[model samples]
Target: MEQQATAPRPRSIAPVDVEQAEAALIEHYPRLVRLGYLVLPPALGRNRRVLTAHALVQRALPRNRVGGAELTVPAPRGTDGVPSEPGYTYVRQRVLRAALDAGRPRGRWQPPRPGQLPPLLPRVWGLRLFPRSGGADELALDQALSSLSGPGRAAYVLRGLELSDDRDVRRVLSAAGVEDPGAALAEADGVRTPAGSRDTPLLESVEFDPCSLQARPTDLMRRRQHTRAALTAAAAAVVCATLLGLPGDGWGRDGAAAPPYAQNAAAEAALDPAKLTQATSSAWKSADRPGFATWPARGDRTGDRELLRRALAAWARPGRAVRVTATPGTPVGPASGPPQLLFAGEVDAAAVVLLHDGVRVVRYAEAKSGEAGAAALDFARTDAADADTSTAIVVGRTDGNVRYLTAPWVTGTAVRDLLAPAAAGQPLHRDAEGVTDATPSPAPSGGCRAWPALRLGSRLVTDLGELVPARLTVGAPGSPRDVAGAQALAGWAHSACHLQSVRSQGVRSVNAWQFATQPLPGGAGSAAWLCTRAETWRGAGSRVQAQFQVPGSRPGAPGAVVARAEDSAACGARDPHVLAGVLWKSKAGAWYALAAGSDDVASITATGGVRGSARGALLAVPARAGAHAELSALTTAGKKLTTLR
Candidate 1:
């Protein structure tokens, strides 16, 4: 885990300063632009959109009356820095509201007002000496968003771009005159461009100040030529057929070697079976080094790998029509039956098949006729030799990501113990991506999410079975996070990660507990975070009986611990489990703590000390701290689970 630098937290609202206000606005200016772009639904042109977005941010900041007449506005601030009420968050909500006002037909204000600067005829940024690359993705998204109704667009942007929770999302929808937040959420989920695809990331700025941008007339003309040429090339790339055209001799409008306008040999071969066979067996004019499969299979191997490879190779060829041998053998693998061709007969015309023998998996199209083919053949042979007929293959679009093969949850003591609550109707939980593995890959180096860990029920189950919880950290922040909650438990699970705007639902028939984050005192990019832990139990079936208790943790004033040792009357939860630990400052002005879970809730007689039914055990290093740092987690049962440093 990376250490978080402790910065002083504002205990209460302070008078605003001009420098601080400008700095905050400048720092967050890009984010405001992104939010504005999404909120308005981008119907206006780029420059207009940028100008309008800035105007919205101006309206959203904090304002006060000067001399009981003129209004003086300042940067916003709020109490305790809750995601719902933080200063930046407050301004963001107002911007969203302003966007709704500008975008809707019946909105309070009509945007594209005459006061904004007119669109400049040219983009100087596009006039670079080198050809500027473009993604058709942004254009696609703009079109998609424009088609949505104003409210739906607002909901999508808030949930998709702003990363608001269902609660915040619901509020936005309400502001837009929509009553069903859940349905709106589901609809947004359906229409939104997927997260990891070509969708324009909301964090990046694509618009520039057109008024200040400059370019020479010749360069501008050249840029226009390049733009048309690039579009032409891109259009050509998407087409499957190769028509007659002058070969690579001509310079494209952009002054680069035009892609050779030659026919696809694969397409030519597919029109004739004999041609297909000849093409598959022919040696490549320029072959790369040997890899996974470049050779043939042995005598006893039931499957004709050579034939399979050739068939798939032929299948992958453009404009080429191909088919498997009339009948495939009962090759066993994926299931207890014959060899399985996943998505068999349905491979996209542009795609090929992949074969795996439970050990080494290879993309058949990538196989060569020598060492690579031999390696692939050997892989199948070895699996067959062991009588493991679990050979199966997956077919899909050709992006190089390799999805790991997984098996059904095994019936074992470990699986049983962790899911013990399921017998009481407590649904088992996994991440939305399905049962990927026991743990996920790693935290994306760049993104909103941060690292988190937890222990549940008195015993924490592992691959080896339920035992004391492991010392958790960022080591495994990827898939297959331990299943922690169902809908009932999930209600309170919100505290685990208040910072996360997007969320994952149930998988493996269970729900994995996820976390939310808050910005570090410095700014965006996750650094410091505030989260909590709790113990759960089932009374009747899988319902996380109202008895489940959540411990409270308040990280305030930089690295200082402002533990909610005592519950306030406003604490609305049914079971307000209180955890306690010392707040110690370190010599270097950093704050940290080493603590264990003790069920010792302090009693009325004890003088500000540890107390509670801290039956659970814990050990964590909560970031860095100045002076002597202390830590603890307490239970609502009046027991204190504390560790002092």
Candidate 2:
């Protein structure tokens, strides 16, 4: 009787509502594009790769007849009853299958006939490292994909591009209809598919080889994660290692004290009390520059001596067995005056070189980056500034393999209160003995007032310098012993390569070895050092400290600066040995920079050139209500002085 009213209840619906499905797919397009970018290499131009992948995704998904802006049909769901993470499994599976199909050996696995398959297989492109932008070769990627069965190509793409984690990657392979998806995925990880091989002769004119990326996908994954950490740690280690050695030859194995020389004492005295003088002022001042009272003497080799004692007390923890040794064969000449300092660090290999005369100290990486060579695996730089009282230059290195160098163009106290101890004593060979007998002391007797310059080394400095033993004010993480000895060896091995370079004079026999000594009782870690005889030339004429650096790193980043001093006396009132400086990234990200006295800012490009700018005039005295004489004098004299401020 109610047939009219009950008429709607009798109809059974089809499994998938096509009209609603089409609507859902329209909504899914945006997700498809994002997923494609994530799955593909960044080097692939954004437009082409993503658009193609989107089109492919649209065709693959179940669609509805309603095709305008709105999706008319409901999207499909897995048996698990959830919409998957847009690209998580399905797309990953497809990409892998696609890559495999393109690269699989023709005879190893049979392929389905073209008539029975998806229309776009021939249009699919296997991903390539360097894809051709526009030309006949442009279709090469698609051609490669067509050679594989769908499932094989998907496996190759996902694994090679670093798209997903292991378990998920497996699941994706299975869903793509791959035979023994597990085996194929694993094989995809290991063997080079023909289409993917970079060097393999091409099936067509296209040069891309999908197999070139073949590797245990997990192996590639592990490498990617470890690189960042490894590079940072190695760089820091090198800086610590090299700077530690700059002070002196470390203590000898048995432990004996060395003697301090007049040159060492003079270097120490020069830094004690510098006055902030004008750039045109004479090198020396009437004030007796008070040397750091706690600074170690040249002969304090055993690390347990009085020099280290004072140094540790004043500067914080001092490493044991610190020593300074002049390169035995270096041609010793009359003192040019004060020695100019230089610091260098490399990223390809974890190594830092501190040069005063010869390579006063050197440290190397045992592993990581690439392979240790002159190539810019890491970036470096150097800088300098006037600290009101004195002038100093600092060189810094970073992970990207870049270096920066900065210094004062004119002689003023450019650097002062260098934390580096005087070159003294024989090197200590073990970590257990890196401390001095000196009693604990206070903060720097006086603030270090000087002009500062810095050098940027190639690559990031990775050593957690915070972990080394240093003055608490210096921010070392732990006592030096916490990371010294063989444990430090691990640091060396974790980098891309060790730093090696021919000295400017080109002494073929130069060999510098750097390692950490035993931790001292006071919790200082010392760096051991050794150098052979060689010839060195300091600057005399225009004072060009030619520093070679690998840029490629953000500016103001840390690096190592190597300085040569033709006349040590020229560096009077400044620390002539070694020092470290902070590197900040520049706005454009190319050059490293530093500012001196508010108005002057100096910038050093990655390629190594110096340029400076000044903001305002200070020479003219401001007129005051009561000070007529000084104002009148400045007004008259200031008019005569004309130069860009």
Candidate 3:
């Protein structure tokens, strides 16, 4: 959250042209951060106020950065006191809701013991924007804002500043996790106009620009820029130091439309039913990437395995979604297959229990990895799920892959097409369809079976995007619209806080998944070990440095730690991102990494040791941490061009 322009925010909730939406977001950038500054104080902490606000803004940046679709959000009120702006109210309400939700106290709420809790509205440290220049006035406002309950505070902000209709404010409040909307409304009404303060003191003031509160830190920003440039130059100069680039943003194909794959879908390699049960199995295995392990392996092969497969199929019904996963280190109990009670990877070693309900809401309880996962919950009971809720729920992986359920019945074709190519040459089951049915598939006269038939004509769809008159595809489940009829339901409400709370969780979760797969960075080495804590202060995201011991680099020489990939899942044998580096040490025992590259055969053979090959050259010099030396460039083929020492 540096005092700099950040990734763009969304401009509208309603589907609009992508470029127009981006411009709208950029136009409101400053105001958006200010709103975030106030709302996110609780979650991000007031201490690093600037950074936290920046983080929230950055978090709102869509997944596909350059050109992508927009997410669903409550449409703005046309000049309802507040001037009209596309996505203004939409982004604002979402930012506020995100802050409130993030700042919400976890677990059953209890008043903190007198001395147990830190003071409410502790003084803001990093960056402050307000009426008091960090004086009593600012503190008073902070006290007032913090004093209000999460929903109460949100409701107050909406009505007071947004001038949102009262009903609309309350509706948004309910969407922000208020169990009782009426209670939240009552609380906001009582404090709509506090005794002596205006709702938005900082915002309503003439001196509202945040820069007025503090001078720019040009030196720090400049230092960051220079450091990256220097480091990149040194990295690019080495033989094996490969290039890294951000992911492309195109969501769908342009130019020419290929023939619909459904016609030729038969050519796809057959899927292996047994493969689905393995922790490391996928229907879409390819030479460059591993098959996804989210989907269950073959069903109908065994009693419990068949049940699990039937459960997965039922969950994938049109309205249901579910994906089963096997966390690493979990015991592969006998060849019997993973049961409902399997180890879940978590800090407290929680186990993820599989639910029979057709929707997915992977639940974790307070327990150890191998100790839990036994108890399952009704899909409705998990995170506001209701009777129409899915028996199983599906979630997408960091890569655009999903293993889960849906509602209604479409023949097994959808599941088959969605599955990784079945094991290349396996005999096909003309009726694999029944096993993959969203509706419960009957067990072949046998061992185990799924109980209770699915409720018909009771499809669950809590999202408004899909229900909207003309739904947009850019952002969904994460779109801001929490309810379809909020605006009209709230008689006096001008703006609806179209919310997609799932997006909030999705943004953080993707990084969590990305960061979790560290042991697999495709570096060629004897073995790599974790050497440092994950440092997330890299401005963009967290990263950790690790080293693998390359035997012949030098006697007693340990491998040098280098930048690890943030999204290692996308990297593979042909990874363009460099992976491992050689150790350059001085007699004084200080060491530095001269260069790093993929540890694949050619790269490892070329860059590992001082003893060089005709096709490879080792650029060696006495280097220490933060120590820079002139570097020479080499072609990918290892041909040397003398540029500098």
TM-score, one value per model: 0.25, 0.23, 0.27
Candidate 3 C-alpha lDDT tens digits along 474-531: 1011221222132211210111111121211111111100111121122332222221
How many clashes in candidate 3? 56
Cα RMSD to the true fold for all candidates:
23.1, 26.2, 26.8
lDDT digits (tens) for residues 1-645 of candidate 1: 998432222132234333444455566766665676566634343434555666666655556421112111222222222232234444555566667666544334645432132224222343221111112233234435555655667777666555545555665455434545566566666564523344545324242222232222233533555566566655554442242244652312111112234556543333222321211111222224221122112112114344343433333331111111110112222211122232112121112333432333323332221221111110121121110111111222111111221111211111121112222221122222111112211112223121222222222222100111121111112222334345322322333232121111100011222222222222223222222322111111111111111223221111223343221211113332332333333345554332322223332111223222213432223343333433444454645433211
What is the C-alpha RMSD, rounded to one decimal, of candidate 3? 26.8
lDDT of 2 at 317: 17
Winning candidate number (TM-score): 3
In order, candidate lDDTs are 0.31, 0.26, 0.32
Deviation (Å) of 371 in candidate 3:
23
lDDT of 2 at 5: 19
Cα lDDT tens digits for candidate 2, 119-234: 35324233222222221122223323323334444555545443344444455545443456555455455433333336532322221322121111122423444465466657
Q: Rank order by TM-score, top first? A: 3, 1, 2
Q: Which 10 consecutive positions of candidate 3 have the poorest summed lDDT?
A: 466-475
